[model samples]
Target: MMPQLRTLTMMRGTRARILRKICRNCPNLTTLQLHGCQKMNYSLLKYIFEKCPKIEKLIIANNLLADRQYAELVSRLEHLQSLEVFENRRGAGPVVLRFLAATCSKLREINLSCDYHPLEDVEYFVKAKRDTLTSATVRWTMAGKRPGCLPLLQKLDLPHATDLPDDAVVTISRGCPPLRHLSLTFATSLTDGALAEIHRLKHLQILDLSGCSGLGGSAVAHVAQLAALCTLLLQYIDDLTELQPSLRHVLDLKQLRCLDILYSGHIRAVAFEEFSVRLVNLRELHVTYEEEDEVFYKNVFAEMQSQMPRLRIINTFRWTENDFLTDYETDDDDDTDIGY
Candidate 1:
């Protein structure tokens, strides 16, 4: 009497016996989302995957699934093309990831989040020999450098996984030669050494180095070298005392469409003519300042509009300061990060 559903979502009170009975009837289900569930019994997870062998996407968030059960997920979900897991319990470790690399041959996208980050575990996942990977997102993980190569990878997002050093950047660059989108927001340990390595990503289009306090404007000169960059995010950086001068070097990146510097509190003011004159393709501009610099920003935006009319300014006239849409938890170390 019930419809042949392809999606199943349950938030709480997902009992093992009840799930067993339900999964048996949903043989065609391709997506399963378990949200905010306190207890994810191993039997239920195994039974669901076993019964629904055709699943393509699986999301497990804010739940208490044991380490073995998470391992069960990687081993059982062989047909999964997408997997999103929020392992707040530190269940997603090296062993689980290594198994995933060996078993999930068709996997393409993975978003992995962790709490109380285990660096070795994440390193194993990143360095594992997964040949089909293209997009990978990581959060609160202490992932290390590459142990192997990944030639086909394209997009990598690691907003707050801690302890990524410059060497880690170079390693990932050498490992994943085709990376295009990279986010290393708040990676405070990265220096110009890391930026120097970033130039190797010749195809890189979008880059987010916000809140990386250790880097200087001199270090940012390499970012300008990325000719293909379309979106550049340098928001909330605390140590950029020489930002204005560095703006000149990036004028060559004419393909840029979006630029964010709204919360880079250390940057006092940037001359419009220095940037707007060369950024003919720019569409969005995000900027913030001390009370003294508000007038400076306004005057520049006004002059820029007169010249390059297509540019869009965010929260310009009525400046209301806002937090980063997504800032994360991390510690002081050197490396890049991404989460799912």
Candidate 2:
């Protein structure tokens, strides 16, 4: 009689009979991670819930669950403390979202993707229990789509927050003192002056200021001061043929694992060489193929490969003149349609 299992991870193609037997055998599982399980349905879920009443975390990523079954699952696991909903095909709609927000009194973190009505759902969840939440990720549901309105989140992740010439940046910085992760990709009106506000968020571990046009290659110095920064995404940030010392401040981050400064913004051959040498723990570096200027990217990539053999590169450079235009917005959001 083996029991007291606190965490269980079942791989894909895990048969229902075996899954049920496992659940029955170890009834104390608090964290169940069974992504890519095509056979997942109400019966298996019901058995799991019945056997594992103490479950506090559930991850059903990349799995297909019927629309109606979500509520049943939630109802069975009102005691859940963490949940992952959007990594699958059929997403849980507002009804289910609202139900979870209301019922899951112990919920401290949730990973959700929103294409439409992005702001409303997030606001509801946060407002429902302000003190309970410690982490939240409003991942962009579709790559083609951009994030819309967002609440005054400790971790603000708006695809586009209206960064007017002045008040917007101040408001953004002031709103999120508790911010740990901020992704303001393609943000409008962000200027060099705004760095003062952003730099104050020292708690930030992940910062994505990629595709920002208004910044115009001016804020990396302040960013380097963030002691907790780990992953920095700066794709197509500005026009630069070589890496300046100001920009090279990124090398200061001791914990940085992933750096995506593609589009060859001021990063020259020597700078790239220095970058490869400095980052001991670097795992991924994304850069564009400077076909026109073979001296820049081609040489840099060759040197990087030689220096760091274990690093991964996402070479889908596909850069165009339009890349200089960082304004990532479309009028499609005016309709306020919710993705169901």
Candidate 3:
């Protein structure tokens, strides 16, 4: 009777014994996710592959194991749809991912962000015949950058490849087309010229250039041309003069929702004043504020309530070391008052 039951064994602490029994007996079980458990090993995986003939989604995230063990696991899990093999080290991710891509046939989405590598040789997982791969996120330190081709990709999030030159950026930009969400944090090699290539992607909805310190006004302006954009996260972008050129095109983005401008001390009061009026569609705004203009954020928040009713999350407060210490002291005060 247990062999007929499907979709069991997920997110419970005491169900270890029950799951083991089910896996030993159940032939109908398909989806299995055993994350953050120390007791489980390759034997458990071997049992599932040996017993369960049908498997669609197999997630074994954050499970520390040797490279050989991981390779063996991937080879055995032949019918996986969604595979997440995130590792603690940088090189392990690519090693495991390459092995899985070679082993799995019907994968749809994969997340390999823990791998600390530069945009190294991208693992071409999608089959040439045709596939249902729609979403993927790969984060790596600057090891190396190369042109990658994923035919059936819709959503992609990559690390800031500061080492990648214009040619490398161009290679990636050419490969992925019509992307919905794009993030390029700490991509130091990117310049205004790379922005031109990005403008070709008309389907982009979210753009995050948080640590792109080199992006000038021309690039920002080019990015603002994408009318479909809803969220923009820009942190540590020191180039202030170029913002006006970028902001000029932002007024056209009617669907723009959230903006996070943390640590951009270069932004003047005039920029926010103009930005507040132009960003009628913005729901959340985070920016730097001088000690003198502390009241300005409050005023802007009040005015925005009428037009930006969706503004549920607002961070108009300035971030300072003193503020951090004060908050820490307040927390300590509460802890002391409670006699902890």
What TM-score fits each model?
A: 0.73, 0.64, 0.73
User: Per-residue error at 91 for model 3, in Å?
Assistant: 9.6
Question: For residue 253, what is the lDDT in candidate 1?
Answer: 82
- For model 2, residues 1-340, the per-residue Cα lDDT tens digits are 4697899876666778888898899888899888564477777778888988888888765333224465557556757887766454445334356666776778877766533234565556666756666556554332232222223345656565444343455555655666778777776467767676666676778888777776634477778778778788877656543324467677787777888877645445225676576877778887665546656666667778888898886765555665553334435556553332
2 or 3, greater by TM-score: 3
Error of 2 at 59 (Å): 2.7
lDDT of 3 by residue, 1-340 (tens): 5767777656644354665676778787677666454355567666656777676666555443335575576566566676565553433333544445556667777765654322343344333212566676666344443336555666776675666465555655677675777777888777777777776666778888788777766776777777788888887766555555665565566677877777665555224545456777777777765566667666765665654566654454455565444434666446554322
- Lowest-sum lDDT 10-residue window in model 1: 318-327
- Model 1 residue 269 lDDT score: 40
lDDT of each: 0.70, 0.65, 0.62
Error of 2 at 12 (Å): 5.2
- RMSD to the hidden true structure, all candidates: 9.0, 10.0, 5.3
